[model samples]
Target: MCEEQTVSLVDVLEEDEELEEEASAVLGGSDSDSCSYPQGYVKRQALYACNTCTPQGGEAAGVCLACSYKCHEGHDLYELYTKRNFRCDCGNRKFSGLQCKLYHEKDAVNSQNKYNHNFFGVYCTCRRPYPDPDDQVEDEMIQCVVCEDWLHGRHLGRVVPDCVELQEMICESCMNKNPFLWTYAAHLAGPEVLVEERRDESCANVPKKAEVDDVIEPSCKRSREEVEPSCRLKVLQASQQKRDQSGAVFWPSAWRSKLCSCITCQAQLSAAGLSFLLDELDTVLAYENKGKSSEQVHQGHDPLMSALDNLNRVQQLEIIHGYNDMKTELKDFLQTFAAEGKVVTSEDIRHFFEQQSRKRRRVDAGPFYCS
Candidate 1:
C-alpha cells in the first residue's frame, strides 16, 4: 500500500509504465514495448485504432494516429491508459476464468517495439466459423449469439483461466455464474452500491492493507484463474431455499471461490469474526464472574446468542452461496449440529462459526450476481 498522502492518479499511471519498462529490462524481454500491456496503457500513437470505431465494410476511423479505427465519444483514454482496463459504451468484458469475449486488436509494432492499436488479433474459441464484424464480409470467427459479436479465439491464446474472451472484451457469463467473483466485481465497479464504512478522517491517507495487522493466508490468494477450470455443481436441497430461524436467506456453493476452496483461506476469514466475538464474550463473562446476577447473564445471553446465530447464519450462507455443492452440505451440517445428542458446546459452536466465517470472506460474495 502506498503511504504517500498526495499521490495523483496521473503519477500512478506514469509509475506503472516506468515499472513495466524496468520489469521488462530485468526479465530480458525483447524490450518494454515488445511486451504486452493492457490496451488502455498503450501510448496514443501506438493504440489509436479502437475496435469501437471500426465500421463494417467501411474505412476505419481516420483521426486515429496509429490505425484507422477511432474511439467513441466519452471514452476516458487516461483511465484505460493508466489502469490498463476500461469499460466503454462498447461494453465491458467479464472475466470468466477462460478467454476474453471481446475483440482484442493487436497493437502495431513501433521501432521501439511498442505496438500500434488495431493490430490485435481476433481470438476465437475452438476454431468456430463466423463472419468478421470488422470487414463484415464472411471471415472465419466465433459469433456470440447473445451479443451478435465476432470473437477470434486464437488471439486470446490457448488457455484463459476462468476468463471468457468475447467480442474483444471479457465475458460476463462466466463471472455471473460464480457468486464471489460477481460480488467483488460489483463492488469494484461501483463503490456507491455497497454499504459505506465510516472511516476516520485522520486515516483517509492510510492504505487499507497497512491498517490491517493479520498476515494474509495463502488460500486467499487464489485468483479467478484457479477457479475457472472446475465444473460447478448445483445442489437441489429444500433447506437451502428456506430462511433460517433468523431473517437471513441461505445461498449455496460458498466454498467454490479460488480462496474459499482452501482450508487456510477459510481459517483466515473465520478468525476475523471469532476475534470480535471472543472480545465481546470476554467482557460479558468478566462481569458475570464478578458476582453479576443471573438477570445480567441472562440478558447478556440474548445478545451473545444473537451474535452467535448471526455468525453461524453468515457462515452457512457463505458456504451455500460460495460454492454450489457446499450449500447442501452446509445446510445438512447446520441441521445435524442442532439435532438432539449433538455435542454442541460453546467452544464447538465458536470454532465452527469462525471456520465458516473465514470461508465466507474467502468466497467473495460478488460472483453470484451483478446489478
Candidate 2:
C-alpha cells in the first residue's frame, strides 16, 4: 500500500491546509457568495477597489467580496483588506461601467465610508504598492492603531519596538493632532520597556488618582451633582497638560484598558472624537478573530488522505510526483494571468495542463546522442 510516497503526499496536503487557514484569517467572516450591500454599513469587513473602474486619482470606492468576483472578476483590484463602519459601494456612482450582479439594488453613494491613498493602491511614506515589484528591499506594512493606515517600519519616524504584535501603535500624525495623548503615553503606555527609568519624573504633571479624587470629591462622600463640576474642572486642567513625545508612541498590549474611566475622562474622550479607541471590538485583532471563527471547516477535505492507504507504493510515488510537478508548474503557469489582471477560467486551467502533458510526452521521447 502507499508508504514513503504517501508520507510526501500527506506533507504536501498539510502545507496546503495551513495556507487555506491563513487566507481565511485575512478574509474574515464575510459571506463571499452574497452581496454585503443588503447588510447596510458593516462595522468591519474585507473590502476591495477595482482599478479597472475606480482608477487612481478618481473618486475612491470600495466593494464587498461578492462584488469583487461577480461584478469585477477580470478587473485589477486593490485589496483594502478591512475597513470599519463601511457599506458596500459596488455599482455606485463612482464606477463607470460595472453593475452589481449579486445584489442589483444599491444607493448612489456610501458617504460614511472613509478613504486614504491606499484605496488607489499606494501605501507607506514611500507611496509604493504592497508588493512593490521594483523594490529590492523587503519590508512589512504595520497598521497604526489610530489612523488604521498601513506604514512601513522605516518611515514610522521612530524606531519600531520589538514584539510589535504585542503593542498598539499611534502614528506620529495621530499623536501630533492630539498632543494630549502624549500625556497618556508617558504616564500610562505600557509593556514596561517603553517606560523610562524616570517616568514619574517626566510625568510629574499628571495628577495621581487619590489627588484627582480628593480634588473632585473634597473632604468626604458627596452627591453626584456636588462632585461633577470639580471633576470636570480638574480633568480639563489635566487635558491641557502635555508630555514631550519625541516620536510615535508604542502602547503596551491591552493599553486601551489603561485609559481613565472616570465620568470626566469619558466626557473628554467623547469631546475629542476618541470614543472608538475605548472599544476593544474595533481592533484589527478582534475583526480577524471574527473571520477565523466563521471559517467553516470543509468536511471530506482529507478524504484523499484515507484513499491513499490502499494504493501500491509504485502508484503512490507516481501520484506524489505528479502532484508535486503540477503544483510547481501550475503556479508558474498562473503568474502570467495574475500579472495581466485576467481571471483564470476552468477551461484555461485545463488547456494549460494539456499543454504540459504534451511537453512531457515530447521530453520522454527524446534521444540523447553524442552530447
Q: Write the per-residue lDDT of candidate 1 for residues 1-371, one digit (tens) a residue.
A: 97434433345446877775443322221112222334343221112223333332433221222111222344322111111111122211211121212334433322222222222223243322223444444433332221222344333221221212111122233233333333322211111111132422221322233222112222234674543322111111211322112111111111112132335434533553222211222221222233234334445766544655756777866544656655665556545654543433455546766877877676656466658
Which number leads on TM-score? 2
- CA lDDT, candidate 1, residue 250: 11
Superposition TM-score, candidate 1 onto the true structure: 0.18
Worst 10 residues of 2 by lDDT: 190-199
Instruction: Give the per-residue lDDT digits (tens) of candidate 2, residues 29-81.
Output: 67789989988988778899888999987898999988898889888999988
User: Model 1 scores what on Cα lDDT?
Assistant: 0.30
Local distance difference test values of all predictions, in order: 0.30, 0.72
Candidate 2 clash pair list:
28-291
User: Per-candidate RMSD vs. true structure?
Assistant: 30.6, 12.3
